[model samples]
Target: MSKKPFFLSIILFTIFLFLKGNLLAEETVKITLLYTNDIHGRMYPYENSIIAPETEKIGGFEYLSTLVHKEKQENPGRVILFDGGDIAQGTLYSNLTYGISMIDLMNKTGYDFSVIGNHDFDWGKEKLGHMISKAHFTFLSSNLVTKEQGEFIAGTRPYALKNIEDIRIGIIGLACTDTTVFGPESNISNYYIFSGEETLKFYIPILKEIHKADLIIVLSHLGYEEDVKLVSKVPGIDIIIGAHTHKVIEKPVLKDKTIIVQAGNYLAYLGKLEIEIDKSTKKIINHKGELITILNSQIEPDKEVKYILDKYREKYEAFGDTIIGETSTVLTKIPYKECTLGNLIADSIKITAGVDIGLINSGGLRDNIPVGPVTMEKIYRVYPFENMLISLDLSGKDIMEIIEQSFSGFHAILQVSGLKVKYDSSKPKNQRVIEIMVNNKPLDPKKIYRVATADFLALGGDGYNGFKKGKNLQNVMLIRDAIIKYFQEHSPVSGKIEGRLENSGKEK
Candidate 1:
């Protein structure tokens, strides 16, 4: 052949090889991200009444572990497991052990990382530090800063970088700023929380520019609305695993190429997000996500996790199994309205503290009491905060102000005893309380009355700032203990809503 033809052949061969290599590099890579949020220390399967009406056993660490392991077996190295936070401080197991049991379970189940939640600070800073030290997985939160030192909280990373099959995944964590207001105030008083948007703005560019991260994920303890806002404002995030609202997102929400997923509370569901990325461009070409219900009958329990859970159950069986009381009426929690269970709890506080009025935030009532029987375990699930009751001497004016503030926000509605309140939510805030009565008489501005409320309120949690002006502050007893005592004395108790709170407005 001629020299020109030979040269042309060599060039053609080089171009062919280059194009073939580019095709191979552009091939899509599939990654599966399995996540859980707001587990709240559910180590064993139990019937969750909130998720379903029937008494079918639902979520547990064992079932979650089985699902995770099976996913890993199917997908191999492409599977990554994570938790969204609120792992501690829900069940008797977590409360009794101070979160160690949950941490061990997370370790056994092979969690890659988790974010910090407000409830994780319930036991105090030192205990939170202890739990962080014990956790085998990394904890991430980019926005939490110390007050005195102006540094990130110890034992937490701002972000994490993981490499799987030539994919550089950057995971950033953001915690809720409400921790200072809703958590143990003293424990978090030394820290200041920054906004998630600011943190993302600072970190996303760094992850993309310096770290060369192919994909960015956020583990956020911010609620659903906040997560939606974050994705709308920030441009680089690919996925957000959200918690703190206890929302059951049946399907992942996608906005502007970002996916948000939350698996409700108490391990009722497991969230999974799968994405096929164009390796060359580091962009997701296709993705799908779903919330998988952790039904015990559908998924077999992991033997090792079940064994560990049994050990903890055996240790706390006596306290958890004790009969607290029985209720003739179903004490259900009605959000944004007066609930029968809330009435019972408020009544318990009034009787225990010998106060003229009892006030408790509705958010403190977490679960409904079944009519047939009640146990310490059931009560703990209802009132899991472990809040102590405090007796406060407040003038009728201050009490009225507190009630008005509660009516300002739907979630802040106060459960009450020894008093009646009628509000028109259509009216402007700070003026929503239409009428207030104490002991069947109009509230007197000057007269002082004894008020019993949780210490959380006395410290001005949930925007009950009027409680701060309370005088003669006295610690009465643990609110849970007081309720337990009331149940012991009032077995087969009748908890009913007798129109103590009436919304007279046209708006429902």
Candidate 2:
């Protein structure tokens, strides 16, 4: 054998080894991300001894802990936990405990980061600030900023970068733009809410340039559609975990290179994503995702989280046990296509306002009233949202527009008081509102009218986004306060279902 041939063979073997080693070094790292949203401070299962009508209780901090632990165990060291937000208010417990309990629970549950939700600011900016300070995980928000008792306004951080297993992931938080409309005056009246798209535009370049993260993830409370729109306006976002629409997305919706996932509401589901990244090339190789249902039969509750939850449970019962009034007849809330309870409550607001008509968004009705003795507990359950009563002097044309918008869609099923409206559902959009009358009087299109409605509607609830554009807006009263006041004045009472619904110009 020639020595030249032997040398050539050695060189070929050495080159093969070098190329193989480079390929092995470029291998991707696997990361599993778990997400939840709109927990609404449900520390314990919905199975409270105080409230009746038994349904399978699914979510609680304890159960959530158990589920998250299982997820971690499944993925071992490659898991990341996140909550999209709304850990502030909703139930009797959050309202009574002032959100410290929930914060403690979130810290205990190992949430790595959470975006500031609209409800997080429900208790006001000071309280929200305190919650952020107390939280163990980073409270990531890119849009909300504080006015330092001066004229200057600053936007929140652009995004946060997390380095896990050689992969750099940037997480940005986007608060809902409807903060001005949904949140209380005290929480956001001073600080303005900028467009989510604008904030993202300002941040994306900075994150890419400064952080040099391989991937960008947006922790958004801007609802799914808004997130979809955002990805189109701003390029380069890899994933968007969204909330505020309460949509239980089974699969992540990918739009223009942005993958969006929302874990529904009330802690009923978890969003999961697995991403494989090439460390050497600094690129995402593959991604997989799914939504896991948190059913009662699936997992056991964590004892420590349960213990903390039990303490709040006791506190909740104590607060709700207060006797507000008695009902001679049962006032129950039935989850119908159109709710009778909603009609009654909305009528209460209209009566309180002494207005010609009143409307309440059915979405604002949180819980139900059982068919028995009425207590503060019952009232709280029936009308859970802390909504205020807002009045508007809308012209006849504005009222028609509002009605047309509501009736033409799945959302416009009216829970009204002191008015009868008849509309054709089959008519073209916005033309469906056929006839509207206040006290047997046909609606005057040119005349100004006083209307009472829940604050949620004033800010556009259930696709009625036009309410924000309504003229002469005035917060005449709060819906909850008005209801409480009505109970105080009326004492023990019962109400008959008035003829609120009537046939319009057409048949269904």
Off by over 4 Å in 1: 1-26, 53-55, 179-181, 506-508
Q: How does model 1 fare in lDDT?
A: 0.87
TM per candidate: 0.93, 0.80
* All-Cα superposition RMSD per candidate: 5.0, 6.3
Please, what are the lDDT tens digits per residue for candidate 1 over residues 1-508?
A: 4799999999999999999988875597889999998887777787866565575789899999999999999989999898888888887888899899999899999999999988888888788889999999999988888889898768999999998887899999998877424554336667777899999999999999999998999999998999999988888999998998888888888887898888888888888989999877878888888888888888878999988899999999889999978999888887688889889999999999998999998888877887877888888888888788999899989998999988787455889999988899889988989889998999999999999999998888876778999999999889999999999998889878788999888644
lDDT of candidate 1 at residue 380, scale 0 to 100: 80
Report the lDDT tens digits of candidate 2 across residue range 1-508.
5799999999999999999988875587878989999887666666532322356666777888888898888878778888888875776677666688988898888888888787776766667767877888887777766565632212234467788877788898887777433554335656657788888888888888888878888999888888888888888889898888888888877786678888887777778988888878877677888887666656887998888888877867866777766656645453323355667677778889888788876656766655455566556545656677887777777877877666664553557776677766566777766678877898898988888887667776655766666667777666877777776777566656665555444544
Return the lDDT, model 1, position 444: 96
Q: TM-score for model 1?
A: 0.93
Which runs of model 2 end up more than 4 angstroms from their true locations? 1-26, 47-55, 74-77, 146-156, 186-189, 323-337, 370-378, 390-398, 408-414, 444-450, 455-478, 484-508
Whole-model lDDT, model 2: 0.74
For candidate 2, the per-residue lDDT at 59 reads: 71
